[model samples]
Target: MNFLTDELDYEECDKEINKNDINYFRNIWLAYDDFWHKNKYDKSKYKYVKTAPRSPNTKYGKINDFYRRCYLILETNEYYYPLDNYIKIKKRKRTLTNLEHIIIKNSGNGKRQSDVQDIVKNAKFSKTYMTNVMKNAVIGVEKIKEKKILLPNEKLFVNMDDCFISSLFNNKKQKNRIRTISANKGTDLEKSTKSRNVLKDKKITYMKTKNGERIKRQELIDKIYDFLDLQFIYNKSSLVFIGDGAPWIKTSAKKENIPYVIDRHHAFKALKKGFIFNRKVDNKKLTNAYNLFINGKYYLLLDFLKVNNIDEKIYKYFKNNKEGIINQKENWNQGVCAESDVSHLVKSLKGYGAKIYNDKVLNNLLLINSARINKLNLLL
Candidate 1:
């Protein structure tokens, strides 16, 4: 057996030892002396006194603790999340939550749980224990459900998009099983883009379900509004939602009485798609649409659509978001988009060829990622 069991009477095997003495005991007891002592280390300050038989329990306890720490240090450095090895084997099944927290904390920083598992798999822990630790880690972000408000003078720039998780979709279900992914940045775009902390009041909402994506989407949007309500009520600061001209986003903004901006990238994309996909409009008309969009003449563009009978679904999208598109130029100068921010939060878990994430796991990963991006010390 690699570990000390109850076979030996600890009461009879006791000894008094110093720090280095404990290290030597651990090295010999764990059969690690040959490998450990071969490594070049300083030994000038060593006070090695081997006092025999004080208490076997004391000796076993100290050596076991040292053994655990040695194994933990092999996994990571001080910069990484601390490992949890304080639980006894008997109670480990119930007390491994601390280990789960450690894994989740590492995941928050973009490390996949699978990657974390591979790194520590050789340690004295069971695969099921590690799996449960990671599973709970992803679901654990729910504890942060309380609404968090924005600071004064801070505007929340929001965007919504779709992503796929392997666990949620199969070929028969939908080749591209899309889930709702939304992100918001609370700081100034220009200033933030130049710094590491590009997003100030960052929050990400991810919803995945085998079915009922629409219902979950609405719930996610409502959660955003609840957080906004706290800031809007007390600070009187308005929200500047930035999205790709999605109907749900438009509708939610209108209902909440909040102003929004159409992301310039998506606006251009919409125009191009409308012109190409929707019955081919003349090159002249396409040029005219681009001109109007750039000049912020959104109403005139709508009129052009009406007169020319260029009624594509994208056309309706443009009409619904006329204010947002116009606001992108006149009121909010420069291109304000959330594509980069949103991508950063979702790429690892829901990217191409990625493993399908469970609905709860996907949601939890988003929240954890957002907390990291926003520099919020979320509850693990």
Candidate 2:
């Protein structure tokens, strides 16, 4: 049994006590100390002996008035009961400190719950407790984000893309699901290519849904629209939706009556794929065709592709996404880096051969990752 206080240093106090009626005072003090020690360590003295609450009552009712024995654990692994009475009847409930919640939450970042258990030592939290802590932390951070008002910018660039990770379900079959990420800011391609830190400044939100289900996909789109609506409420800023010309993305923008811009990188990649087999079109002609597209000469570019016997699928791709094509000579759509953002945002979930078994855990992980990316303080 560890006592909360150190024993008295009798030798150090001997000189002071020697001056007056030493034997009489010493005997009295020794008797009192023995009685106090016996009372403190006697198990029968305290009726409620539990160190902490196993399951605290969270609901508001008359039952909550019952007394609960609990102890507080500090960051240094030191714990103590705030109340001296061990068996008093009261309504107190046991809960983790803010710092404890934060430590558990941060330790689990980019890590599995079991991994978090290993990282956090001397804590009474189990894997289930850690999961609940993370879930609650995410909910708290989300509430904070909801109250935040993004400052209006002259132009608000929106980028949306889907990232997929291996599903834990049917592992033998290796199924996949969609985790969509959307941001209010677009990365400058030139700068982003020079340094990856440019993405750190963007505010991102993520959604998880089934890969191919139409209803789920529509729900995701509606959620994204709601996010956008909230962000756009404070500003009359010009909005531009940038993506890789995915059908869902196009549909999302069209439904919202927003302008959509096909990423230039995807556009050029499509052109190269289309012309890969055409040996007749030399490098010079390829460069000329690229220039025609960049210069917004869509009709001439189509004629050039046809004359060069480019693949018809590429022609149709460009024809269908013609409106999304950013004209360097006219529009200022510098393209989007959605693919890279997806890889960066969901790296933890996709890395270390990680697999998510349920939507609840997956959504919690996504929210935690997004909160970390946005540099929101989960400790609050």
- Highest TM-score scorer: 2
Model 2: worst 10 consecutive residues (lDDT sum): 55-64
Q: Candidate 2: which stretches are off by over 4 Å? A: 1-139, 145-153, 169-176, 179-181, 185-193, 196-201, 215-221, 229-237, 277-287, 326-329, 355-360
| Residue runs of model 1 more than 4 Å from their true location after superposition | 1-102, 108-132, 136-154, 162-197, 206-210, 216-221, 229-237, 274-291, 300-313, 351-354, 358-364, 378-380
CA RMSD of all predictions = 12.3, 12.6
User: What would the TM-scores of all predictions be?
Assistant: 0.56, 0.59
Q: What's the number of clashes in each of the models?
A: 8, 0
The lDDT for every candidate, in the order shown, is 0.51, 0.54
Clashing pairs in 2: none
Model 1 RMSD, rounded to 1 decimal? 12.3
TM-score of 1: 0.56
